[model samples]
Target: MNPIKLNLTGSPREIGIQHGRALYEQIRSQISIYESMFQYTSKISWSDVRDIAKEFKSPLQSLVPHIYSEMEGIAEGAELDIFDIVALNCRSEIALGRFSDGCTALSWKKSNNARVLSQNWDWTATVKNNLAMVSIEQIGKPTIYMVTEAGIVGKIGFNSAGVGTCLNAIRAKPMISSKLPIHVALRLCLESTSVGSAVKTLESLGGVASAQHILVSDSTQSLGLELSPVGNKYLTEDASGLIAHSNHFIENHYVEEPPWLSGSPIRLDRIRYLAHELIANGVSGDTITPGLLRERIFSDTYNAPQAICCKEDESRHISTRSSSLFNIVMNLNSEAPSAEVVFGRVGSGEEGPVLKMPWV
Candidate 1:
């Protein structure tokens, strides 16, 4: 174990400020790089950004500038042009915003009937900016957040509440007035009191405008909820039993993939194989360990593709703005959900808590 580093028990507001400071003091340069990149990568309007930001409880929005600066430094170090930066950001949003239709959910009860074992995942992108390796040991626990310039963004974490939330993204048509940035909405959902509330947060409050989400909450009872938001359309599949997910849309009509980026399809294929392999290898619902979870996401397939690469068309490449450090996982028990931040190697070198805010 990493000896349970970082303090996780705090209100959403407190963690949001911590995220701001982490970015300002540790990753300001990288955040700046991303700010410029986001202009083109994200189709959202400045009005939308401001509007979505308005939903935040003042303290979180105050850190946006600080986070932007940190991203800029990462861009400068990598020599990314404006388009390259935007494309990279867009690619990452696709990775973080979308949800896999295959994931299963768990429902909590008043019994210790189920337990978490471990988590292992191996993440790879077409660019160095998105390369990562991580593993989690032990059962479902809490993953806390740290204040980066971007407020309290929960990169990864498990909770005593038996909830495990991972974020990914996919592309869609340009969002106008109705579309909201996913990060803002996710922050709100993370702060929510329960999964039901989290779903409401995304729907009633800070709408993703255009995005996909995979929410996994295990209350000792398996229940998986996959939410997809693209424009005015909303779709979800409740497979709250035994299942897994990857980077692909589920519904046929609503499978809104932009085709601007590639590789996720292949990743999904690998996910299928890995899921079966784990199950066959004696991994069960309650016994899934963090180390196993990491492998499921990041393990290298003998003939599978590598994550980072320098491409001729920079738009196709991933960057730190896309991903620099793979945030480690935090396990959660039966408690209120909080942000379990996984620090990236490139950004802050260590993660601040990713707060689960209360908008959902």
Candidate 2:
């Protein structure tokens, strides 16, 4: 299925208005799915979810009012309360790692010097149709093209400034409502001109609301930020210029993280092994392209349901069954940043048609 493509410009509010109005149906759909997800995963009612979400409003208004303004516009345009939009954005923190949404992210440099950032977003299939590719144009900020949940303000995508980001939800946290949510932090990274600038901005604010690993990259470099409310750690690339992260924390962060999903370690090893193969083959420049990355690394099925290209396990409950919802590979070239997205699991014949980014 073709995801709804939205192009938004103007101030944060105006851009948000376009987002809410265009994807109103999708936004509502997201709300319903999250309501079920929260009830099943966190055992929290939807009403309580919104009440908890309100705590973020004051923090957002004080720290990053622009993003709050965009949420306001979305509420007005979608005819819902601003807190509902906030709830969707903070779903990760509110869920408190009860829900395990697996993903594998990687960053590597091509022979021609383009930095490639890619990942497979694995999650429950119930809300797959609610995903949208949103492109934003704001004054002073870089143009953003992100694939996000209908009501979410920020997520995985690249920007005009050659900065791209991918998210891997780390199921370890003491959810702090006063800090910046992971989605909001992602928006900040996309708005940054380079990875260094993005890292500085996030570090200056302490850290994010929950534990998350955001792989930020540009034409020249890539850095993995393992952010939690308490502190943050940076995971650098290897000597070969490669970084791979799954759901678990690979660094020594003194955090209480038990591997909730057994697949996290298996997938990480599989991806790293595949990435090293590229170097062994003497692949560089033109040889190291997005297509090659998808075909080689992200498509592995080493551990079945827990592999890089995940598939739903029929034995699991409906609420918990998961699969790779979509696979996106971004080529962060300073001159021309672009991405290719494939809906559904990669290499699975059930996957949707390939779509290119910066459409138009």
Candidate 3:
């Protein structure tokens, strides 16, 4: 694969906006909206909205006119305002589209998350400035093209202050399209300075969204948070150390699909096998490391739930569609109490130092 490598280092808010500008442009050419978007979805608590707005800072806001314009264009279909658009930029709100796309986050041990396997996936540019990376998959939607917001981040790479977030694909239609999409909300989680802040940002938002995600961070914590705008519910699974997540829901009352799922039972087993292998082999923050996540995510052979290759048998009329491996990984290998996002891709070259986030 002709993988793209990226290295960007600067202030936190600017880094966030810089990453997103391209996505705004791409969405513009693809989906033409007729009105302005919201700064926050209607159901989101006012408090959460306020905190995220603070994070955007003035400099970040300066670069948002393009996004605001896009919001105006898609407003007829989504019904959002420019303020909601700004809030989405700050990671305060999330847009849950039709069809349940999801995300999951879990913490493996620092020792386990630290491991680094040699990456041959050709992602040299991605490691730098990527303090975080994301794998984007659209099970039944066209809106989720590349993972970064063109780099804006509705969804983003894990590894922020020891917290990692991942999104999933599902099926569901919204009563009202979000002012902010799910990917943007998760990206906001990465921009948080602390795990507590990340948790607060993720759970408080309200909207209809499909999919599952496992958030892992600081090598000691992990969480599986689920959001369903249809059910108007959000749930989280906690762990003291190691954790795993699949495509379906693991909750009781809101169980629609299992987070531990995929296109087939075999796919489910495949992820389990890999998860077990990594953890058993001491996949700690000091061992397994973030680079491995990229390698595994793009692997044509063992990436599990293969992209869309034809199976070996004739009766298998299976559609080998690509799910979540559509985006990049953000490996946040921090060097101090303050985060210095050492970004890189999972499948890229040997993990190396790239951008040192100016926020540090």
Q: Report clash pairs, candidate 2.
A: 111-284, 111-285, 112-285
Worst 10 residues of 3 by lDDT: 115-124
What C-alpha lDDT, on a 0 to 100 scale, does residue 107 get in candidate 1?
Answer: 23
lDDT of 3 by residue, 11-60 (tens): 33333343344234433321221011222224445344544454433423
Off by over 4 Å in 3: 1-25, 28-107, 112-147, 158-160, 172-180, 205-216, 230-240, 255-265, 281-285, 290-320, 323-360
Error of 2 at 111 (Å): 5.0
Writing each residue's lDDT as its tens digit, candidate 1 over 202-299 gives: 56644554444444444443333334444333233223223334444544235445654354555445545565576668766545644445445433
lDDT of 2 by residue, 181-220 (tens): 9999999999999999999898787679999999999998
Each model's backbone clash number = 127, 3, 106
Using TM-score, give the best candidate's number: 2
- Candidate 2 wrongly placed segments (more than 4 Å): 111-113
In terms of TM-score, which candidate is stronger, 1 or 3? 1
